[model samples]
Target: MVDQQTPVGANAPTRSGGAPALRERLTRRKPVEKLVAETQGAEGAGLRRHMGFWQLAMIGIGATLGTGIFVVLGEAVPVAGPAVVLAFVLAGVTALFSALAYAEMAGMIPASGSAYSYSYATMGEFMAWVCGWCLMLTYGVSVAAVGVGWGQYINELLHLTTGLSMPAAMLAGPLEGGLINVPAAIVVLLSMFALLVGVRESSRVNAVMVAIKIAILVMFVAIAVTAVQDGNFAPFMPMGMAGVSAAGATLFFSYIGFDSASTASEEAKNPQRDLPRAIMFSMILVTALYCLVAFTAVGALNWADFADGETSLAGILTAVTGTTVWAVIFAAGAVLALASVVLVVLYSQTRILYAMSRDGLIPKAFSTLDAKGTPRANTIITSVLIALLAALIPLGPLADATAIGTLFAFALVNVAVLVLRRSRPDLKRAFRMPGAPVTPVLGVLSCAYLMFSMALSVWVAFLAWLAVGLVIYFSYSMRRSALEHEDTVEVRS
Candidate 1:
């Protein structure tokens, strides 16, 4: 697809599908020795590269294992029936293809900015802004969404263990008839402050949550498998194909942090090499956990009960094990794990805003750094906004926006991989997407299909978000853009 709008001489790349042109490039006589212009060296971009396998693995786990495994199980199982296990696989498969694309692109760029950076290097500024806008909303709103879900789990854990219960309205949000969730708001603030301190500290914190979350999930799988009566799995695919699609669309929330792993290219020790490893490695683990968790939930209870239940995983576990321990573990895991999601995701979001601010897209304050070498101003502002939104807004609307926006970014990044591969053959890539052009093509299509499957209301909300992004871009970003000023240079390797 030749983007007619794409400008030339500026050298925007064309997307490939392993077609004639792609084959021609691959069959070239020499690889980078077929070099066109750039010089050879270990590094070019100013980014400090020191990320190792441990950090990479931690990031992968941090991003992939989260609210999805903890919450989406209820949303997915109720809709997909016992086949919710399959939906986990389905979403994973779709995500895998795109992650492969991300692996390739991350290897090529190896920048801390994530998808927004890749889009700028390959698709040019306009598309980059679009992607950047989508990413900002994707991670930004998710900070609040996860915070909201976290509040519920905290309430559940308190009531389950100590028999202390908060009013239903307070546990929920103001829009849902609750005043506010102080704990959830605190979690958001805590996560923001953690990031504001530094990535190393934040990663350490995420590691702890990862352990707790996995332990809780392991217990659920063990307990649920033991109680599998075979009767609960009977109504497989009860809602039919439409329901399956809806489940896929709804379950999109679980897959949120897959890309967050790749956003840390600057700090990555061998980023080009380890970045791709972390992305795919983490997805594989997340998919297995999600499938097991969902299968167990469906096996433990009647699917219809999930549709009407106030508490998702907690209710399913209570019904399945005929005890509240499972609920306690699940709730406890959610409470512990959500901090990981919020920390890593807000970290990624701030990095992206830092990039955009460095490029003059938004206010410079977003990229402002304190003595800790962290974005204190940006993190604080982001936390406050997320805290307010989590305190006041309803979950359903926030979830919808996050799902649709994230899927859109996924599809675009997939295509952007192809564009970069074809046009910049000289660029070095540490990790490669399997099937080359074919995989990315399928990735784009799959993601787009999922995006469209969302409700009409979601589309309206997306448009509204994009509209605001566009207004910011045109009125402030475009004019103040470092690119236009010629004072700014792209920080790509």
Candidate 2:
């Protein structure tokens, strides 16, 4: 039989000679200095660094704007009543802290994995594994939820435009009294094909889609503001502080996609400079849009009038305009916009898995690039998994689970920024968080608090998923990790 060892680098040490003990292997961290050097070396880093600040910012906006304003507002408004506007502001503050931390890390690492790469370089391998596992779950589930939102908008648009609509049995998952969500599955497949083609193509398409959605939102706000009733402002705090806080926790999901820009660090032309700008610019821009939409929508009608998951925004437009025309246009815009959300979320998932595979945490096949420099295997695997989930699962509970998983990752990123600053003060950073330890501390605390706001079942689901990740890490990844092999060789040599 051909020796499997022959294909490995001749210098790589084997277990027979001696490898890192299991405990050490799991705890060892990647040096920040080494990570920077490897990135600079340009050794077989297959992705093309073609994105500019504008492209990166557009990607962030595309990823962030769609899911929250278009779908989430319906659920959030009912919880916080008219005070949901304040909830958007609250959520934006939490997002800003995490975004600032991400900016510093992206400027320092400028690689594909986002928080996972940052944690690996600053913290230990085990922390990195946990962060990567959380992100994998968050992005995967978020994409599925976005797909369902797109499906809902498509149905609304069709009923308005052609007097035709999908059957209820075919419009949702079995958990929602339907067999499957066909439109959700369709959007996932469409986005998958776009990714397989290339990042440049997908990103360009996403930018155009983002512009259209923004215009649609601007139009909605303008019309809704005109119809605002003064009495809608009087009892705005009907649900009080507890409701607003809970709503803020839910709205935080809208900001989840801001890190999607950081995940493209390898693909940015000037990652050290452009990534920080993209991260900050996208968060500020999306936050402004969310607050405007929330303020206008609630003012136009009482908060109690907003229905959960019933095409809330479009219904408001139709009711106010005394016609379905504006609603049709709004629904069409949502379909276009949410498709971009799915694309960006799926893109982030494939890249994160690719980074992990390159480290030998999963399998190298996932990191193998096609001629276009894309990890086609990883993309295909992610596409299939997300598509199945979007088709078979209900959206509401899935969204809550996504929130907790993402919060866990955000907290880790905040910690990574703090740890790296202390460990390697000499490393050059293109951007720094304003308050250093203070900002990062708040980032950690806010994320922890929001995570606690989730339902007990959501916490249960997140813990169960983490349990699975630990089993895989110990059984398969601990044996194959490339870092352990490299360390073993250096010690033996």
Candidate 3:
């Protein structure tokens, strides 16, 4: 390992020929010791350490459990039929492979940038920027996607209880025949308020909501199980293996939040120990819940009925009980569940930007924190932009874009693990992934396969997004990056 006090760009070769200098700048790696040191020094001072193991676990659970199970399942089931259950398993397994890679990386590096930080320490400055850019797509757009679902369930709850609904013009985006998704925008702003208050306060609210959502899901399973028809699952693979793969690609959006815990590395009480456990524990709990809910849901209501909207689980409860009472309760739970997703994913988005800002890759405003140890400016800016996205875009396109970005970032993290293992074997890791080289290799292959399974349009959109990121990198971030200077960069107040 490199010395903790080493200057960030101290090892770079001086003023080489044009192409060589550019190559060195792109491939320049930040030392792991410096990565850890920044968190203990002025750069990480504004973030408070308040989260313990369970609170960290709740971060992961709060983010992961909601959107997929509560919202996206409705979208996924119609694509995969009863085999949506298999889709859940496939997505979970792919996530598990990356989760293992995350565990090892989090234990070793422990930074707020998550995979971006890991890449900076192992791959280089340019790859780190690419990873951070993809994460922005993953966390930011996923918040919009979940917020869209929140609006749907809000309408479901209103219809069951008050016999009314939000105006059609306010219920969906223009693409979905509505002028704006008012409820989705509202939910994102509400979550933004919670985050601005402080992470500790936001996390306590998240913990309570996480518990409520899990209980509601368990209740759903118990009630729906009694109504299961063996015949509903008769033609299980209606769309066949291709459908299963496509649904699996779509459903990967649900697994996005499990890694949100890793982003809290700077705020964690015992990051090395707690982060790994939180990442793994949350993945296991979420996978089990997803499988159970998908199985019971298909068995009770038939996969075809899941196209109803974001209220699929509540719809199942109502169908089984033959009344709207339980459906109302389920819808209420879903509102709380999806709101938690917005809070956590939005929180992660700010932290990733904060890390980038501290490295001079972006403006210093994002790194500025208020007295409450919260990134007030970052929170406000991110929420407003996400609110507009949620209001203007429909859920399906938002989700596919998020899934591809997330898978691409995960692939890089796996590669980072392989790189670090070879280059810095002496670094101590609190949690070493069991399978080592083979596991991370599988992680890379699995993520690539899922990304390949996405629609052609999704690939085009993803490539376009990457192109924009490259343009920003070459035009702005490259010249401003901390690695281009010799002085130690400090976070702005």
- Candidate 3 on 1-493: residue-level lDDT in tens? 3323223344434454422256566876778888898876774466888889999999999989977888788888888999999999999989999999999999998899999999898777889999999999999999999999999899989988999988999988889888999999999999999998789999999999999999999999899999999999979999999999999999999899899999999999899999999999999999999999989999998776766545378888887999988999899999998999999999999999999998889889999989877889999999999999999998899999999999999999899888878877899999888788999999999999999999999999999999999999999998898767745421111
**If the candidates were sorted by their lDDT against the true structure, best first, what order would they fall in?**
3, 2, 1
Local accuracy of candidate 2 as per-residue lDDT tens digits, 70-175? 9888999888888999988888898899999999999999878889989887666888899999998899999999999898888888888999999998888989
lDDT of 3 at 302: 71
| Model 1 lDDT per residue over 41-118, tens place | 235333334558667777777766776767656666666777777767667777888888888877777666678777
Number of clashes in every candidate structure?
Answer: 4, 0, 0
Provide the lDDT at 115 for model 1.
82
CA lDDT, candidate 1, residue 255: 80
lDDT (Cα atoms) of all candidates against the true structure: 0.73, 0.85, 0.88
TM-score of each: 0.88, 0.94, 0.95
The count of backbone overlaps in candidate 3 is: 0
Candidate 2: Cα lDDT at 366: 84
Q: Give candidate 2 regions above 4 Å deviation.
A: 1-17, 40-45, 307-311, 488-493
Candidate 1: where is the Cα deviation over 4 Å?
Answer: 1-50, 309-311, 487-493
